[model samples]
Target: MLKSTTPTMVEAGTKTKKKHRTFSLNAKDKYYALLFLGPSLLILSVFVFYPMLRTLYISMFLTNTLGKTTVFNGLGNYTDLLGSPEYIASLGSTLVYVFAVTILTVGIGLLLANLASKRLPGIGVFRTLYSVTMGVSVSVAAIFWLFIFNPSTGFFALLSNMVGLPVINWLTDPTMAMWAVIITTVWMNLGFTFLILLGAISSVPTTLYEAASIEGASERRQFFKITVPMISPTLFFVSTITLIEGFKSFGLIDLITKGGPTNSTNMLVYRIYKDAFYSGNYAQASSEAIILTVIIAFFTFLQFKFLEKRVNY
Candidate 1:
């Protein structure tokens, strides 16, 4: 005898609960996603976009030893920089560095990742120690390598005596300095790159490995066929990043090698910096920076167009 409830009321309550449930997803997932994404977005906005805009704006003028001046030079700065021998040589050197670093980082990173994926004892400790170098700034790492390669008072000098070899001026010599830089960069960066590859490799479903094993696939064959294809996207990503960083290398060139014994190590980024700060020709430096930006942009585009297309499903 209590009361006759309308079906509409019950149906409305049911619909509301259903809507709420449909939209919900274990709040933990949402929180974790935001936690992971927030840091990366902040970094990109602060470090990448802000400086990019400022650099582009500063490139459109003329300045010299007379005083600070902006003469509305249009594309004249770009034309002159492209035509100059110094700029051309720097561009060539920059390309070489990009290739060297990319190849080294990717090759070594993938190899280390493969080894680490085996779940060996103490792998966690080894991984942490390997990545510790990445915490150091590039300038600091460059200086460390400078000391290590020093002729008279360096680790190499002591090692040379162990083998009865004469002391070699690795940093002061034009030929060896760039190699030293590359080795240092590779050693410092490999750990993080390796971690990326290791994660990518692990995400490959265990079923795939079992299937490969069932088919009598050797370990090398399984790696080449399954692991590589699955992890290709990560590899491409790391290589592209390393390439861009190589082009922008200046701290090491300035702090460690000083782009000497001649202009051998004078990367484009260092040239841009020297022109702006040392020579007081901000316009020229900006112009050079623009050129570097364009070059990097072109490579970035190619990477997205070709490499990104190959990302694994």
Candidate 2:
């Protein structure tokens, strides 16, 4: 009996040691996890989080041209912006620009993706051309299009001359300026959107199309029924990203129009830039920046709340 009890005691001791070892390993794993995540967290804290919080704080106070806080204004900056007709007009232009860019970019991207998805000969060349713009910088694209939209010695001017048509004012006219900026933005963004949608379409299983064909579905039917539903998740993702990008667009507006022609193409981001840098109105710029952030956040929330439900996956 004594020998048997001794063996039982030894066995219980070993079991306790095993538990202790497992707990130690788990604690070390947690430490390693935090170690790996530390760099990323530090970067975000320094860049993204700090800047956002600082902007919010600055927006509540009046600031001089040098960005030094002069007085505590509470919500005065926000109220002033909301009341200003210029701000209102800028907001309206932003809405129109965002919607137009999002729609046209995604639409054209989808069309190009579908076309490139075909198995025709030399399709690789077309695919390469479709995605080439993704590598072009915003400034380069803007300058390239500047020549295209130039009233004199530009592509459109030459085309008009050859066709015996009037040379349209592409960038000077108020209405045309907004559309010109939108077109430039769409063209610049098309490559990215096309690549994303192309990947999404490529990931869709071919078996679905085969099944649809067996059921006598036409090409259009297969596209709508099989392809669309299958790739709905990616479509939703691309749409959300494109929408946010449209809201934050600045480069093309800066280089192409500079929010000009009666402020017709004045987007919110460009408005923030002009206020902060050009006009030296730091308080107003901070407030406008905060407003833009809130608007983007609100739209993103709406998309996730309503649109995400439609995503198949």
Candidate 3:
């Protein structure tokens, strides 16, 4: 009886010792976790958070071309921008550009993803070839499109003349310039969208499809009812990122259109650049920057609020 009671006490002590060790290890882990996060936190504060705060502060004042503060304008910059025709036109262009790019990218991505999901010989090669655009940098892609859209000697020019397709100045024409830019944007963003959707589609369990087939569900029904729900999260993520990308797109517009033919392609981000770098009105640029940030934030918040509910997980 004494021996048995002594063993029980020893076991209890061991358990208490284990618990203490675990608690100590957890504390050490937390410390190390923070230590690991320190570099990232420092970088974000210095680069991202600091710039945002500075932009806000700068927006409240009028500044010279050299970015020196000239006068305290308070909200004058904002009001002036709202009333300016150029600003209004920029706003309209931005809206149209964002909507077009977002719709085209997601739609094309879904279509390509579905096609790539098929089990065919050499399908992997095809998928890889199709996703090659993802490796091209925005500047490079813009250059490629520029060559294609060049009015004098581009492929489109040759083809249009050959086929009697009624060639117009793709980059310089105000009416068609935005469409050209939109087409370029959609092509440049296509690979990323395709790859994301492909991964999401592949990750879906085959068992679900089999179960659906057993219930006499058609392929279209299976895709819409089963595949979509399983991959709704990826869809939501892609849409949100693409929306932000559309808003922040400056490289393509700068290279291809430069907000040309009466500023037809003048997006908000490009507008900020034009004001700051070209016009030397850094304060007004900062104001537009803040407004763009707010607009992107509002849309992102809306997506999370309404769309996240439909995401299965």
- Give the per-residue lDDT digits (tens) of candidate 3, residues 193-268: 9999999999999999999999999999998998888989899899889989999999988888888878888889
My TM-score estimates for the predictions, one after another, are 0.78, 0.88, 0.86
Question: Candidate 1: where are CA atoms >4 Å away?
Answer: 1-60, 70-72
- Prediction 3 TM-score vs. true: 0.86
lDDT of 2 by residue, 172-209 (tens): 99999999999998998899999999998998889988
Worst window of 10 by summed lDDT in candidate 1: 1-10
Which residue pairs in candidate 1 collide?
none
Measured by C-alpha RMSD in angstroms, how accurate is candidate 2? 9.6
Off by over 4 Å in 3: 1-38
| Cα RMSD for candidates in order | 10.4, 9.6, 8.8
The clash numbers for all candidates, in the given order, read 0, 0, 0
lDDT of each: 0.81, 0.90, 0.89
Which pairs of residues collide in candidate 2? none
* Clash count, candidate 1: 0
